[model samples]
Target: MAKTGEADADAFVEWFRAAAPYIHAFRGKTFVLAFGGDSLLRPDFVDLVYDINLLNALGVRLVLVHGVRPQVEERISEEAQYVRGRRVTDAATLEHVKDAVGSVRVDLESLLSVGLPNTPMAGAEIRVASGNYVTAQPAGVVDGVDLLFTGEVRKVAVAAIRDRLAAGEIVLLSPIGYSPTGEVFNLTLEEVATHAAMALEADKLVFILDHGDTVDAQGRRVSRLTASQAQRLLKELPEGDMKLYLPFAAQACKKGVGKAHLVSADVDGALLMELFTHAGVGTMVTRMSVENIRPAGIDDVGGILSVIEPLETEGVLVRRSRERLEQEIDNFFVDELDGRIVGCVALYSFAEVRAGEMACLAVDPTFRRGGRGDGLLAAVEEAAREQGLKHIFVLTTRTAHWFIERGFVLGGPDDLPAPRKAMYNWQRRSKVLVKDLEAA
Candidate 1:
């Protein structure tokens, strides 16, 4: 029998191998990490700092932004004078904000400076840099309430930040900005992080919130969301950390930041898990549709075949030769996710009869339950309508009920256009289902 220590070592080796791909993917990429001030009070914050150091050691350029609301509240005697989410920073409040922000900055800097021997950060020569990297303008007044020193991010010193990142130093940003006239203004950490990401065109923007996973209406944790979907969900959610961070995540995506992530600060090693795993432990938001459906190109022939070959062997789909697929590639549509085609359908128009035949609808078994098959069918139908086809039909030995549930009706082979009927495989004994475009 294998010793327990040996077995544990084997597991560690396997897990490290699995994380290698992510480490390679993130190398040389820039990431902006923002956290609430309350996170620093947690015991696991030191572990988080270690994770950040690990990321830097792996060659990921880092920008850190932190909020100080909780810290400021602790320092101030009258918490009622300021709002929780949106603080109206008067002279007294601004002083507390400065003190809180400064103290947090120092604490974070000191944490990152640790290099004690035999510890996780041993020999980690991590250098952190901070400066007047954010320019600000007063928020002025809203709802007739003068938000004295409360300001919004007007600009980010992208060049200076880039220079520091290039020098292998972590850029730290406080929830504070400086005006042209040298006045210090209190800023929102979310705004600062978002603007900095957009200005630098960073690869990712990550928000470490005080909560765990974001749940849907059914209370199921949502793993991913497109910008539009996140916006809609935000409207329905009450005022909370998810609601606060989602808009910034969506804005980062819209402004061309490659990806935005929301992870729970309460979970130890959440950042590392989210960054280094294939399926992250938190919600990820992107600009548009996560899986894009578009016309197939010549290069996608292999992926298309891979998706359909299993179904063809199982007799769920008719087999097509590589040559045939290459020739008819222009008529194919594929649902591509992270460069892999997980779903595909082909549309053949019988223009003489103002009708079309939908064929070869197949989605990877792993993705079938995710509605990709429905999306491909819809795409094919839309293409048919665009070509002025009056109706569309499908021939299937199986999946008849699936199509029927999606608006297709039972139809005889005789209803098919003459050209399509002539090409139908009599030996296959497939059922003909049709749907009218106008009726749909």
Candidate 2:
């Protein structure tokens, strides 16, 4: 038996190995982190700063955009005016905004400057940069009311920011901008972050929400959303900061920002878990469709073979000749990500008995924890249903538990359609599991 410390060491080794791919992929990539001022007031803020330091050390170019809503609210004496969530920013409130932004910016700089011995920041030399990088224009009047000093982002100094990032500095931006006439304007965090991401073509625009990730109608956290799906979700979300910020995130995706993530600052290490782990801890929004399932073509044969060859070699799946797979390629479906086939499954129809066979389910080992397998299964099931099949079954030698957990019931060769039953491998003695499509 292994000792507890040894077991822990093994687990740590496995986790680090799993994270290696992400570390390699994210090196030198730009990520924009946008957060409200309240995030700095949290008890776990030190941990967040440490994670930022780690990312900087790993060569991830960081642009931090901070909001001063709570800070400004604390400094103001009277109720703030707003129209559709945009602050009115009267002359008196403008003074408070300046003070609040200055104070919060100094505190954040102080936190990032920490290099205490025996701490995560020890030996980490993180340089901070800030300036009038965001150009602004007044939001003017909306709903027949003047928004005054509240402004919208007009331009971002992409070249200057790139230079700062190249110089090994984390660029920080307060929710404030300067107009061409040297007039100062109060801005929103979402707009500044989105504009910066779009201008710089950042790899990711991350929003550190006060709450957890986005959820569906049942309140279950959704792991991913396409830009269209996110736009639809915007309609269903209640009036809050998420609703206000989601549009900006979606807009950034449409404008060519790589991906947008909404994560919780309340959860310790949420940022790291979301970035390094396979199944991220937050909801990701992207411009591309998340469901890339499509009917396999002749060109997909190699990719399909790559996914199943190992399983076939291990005896978990039956071997298929290249010629045989080519002939039946039209009956297969593949899950593709970034032009790589990560998973594949096949469906064979027996129209005479209204039954179908689901077979050759496989996913790449590194991509298994995600729902690629489930997606491939769903694609096969949908194709079977389209062919008017009333039942689907699988013959498995090792994945019996997987099928059982997915609602398949124990069955025998006699339960199969006549044509399939005649071909059952009696010598192999594979377990036969069946599911009723109508009952599903």
Instruction: List the candidate 2 regions with Cα displacement exceeding 4 Å.
Output: 239-241, 290-440
RMSD of each: 11.4, 7.4
CA deviation > 4 Å runs, candidate 1 = 1-3, 80-85, 290-440
- Model 2 residue pairs with clashes: none
Local error of candidate 1 at residue 409 (angstroms): 34
By summed lDDT, which 10 consecutive residues of candidate 2 come out lowest? Answer: 211-220
lDDT of each: 0.88, 0.88
* TM-scores for the candidates: 0.70, 0.73
Residue-level lDDT of model 1, residues 1-440, one tens digit each, is: 57998999998997798789778988989999999998899888888899999999999999999999889888778754444457888888889989998899999999999999966879989999998999999988777778889999999999999999999999999999999988889998999999999999999999998854566656666666777779888877765688889999999988999889999886778899888865577888877563488999999999999999999999999999999999999999999988889899999999999999999999998876655776688688779989999999999999997887567899988999997788878899999999997776
lDDT of 1 at 291: 43
How does model 2 score by TM-score?
Answer: 0.73
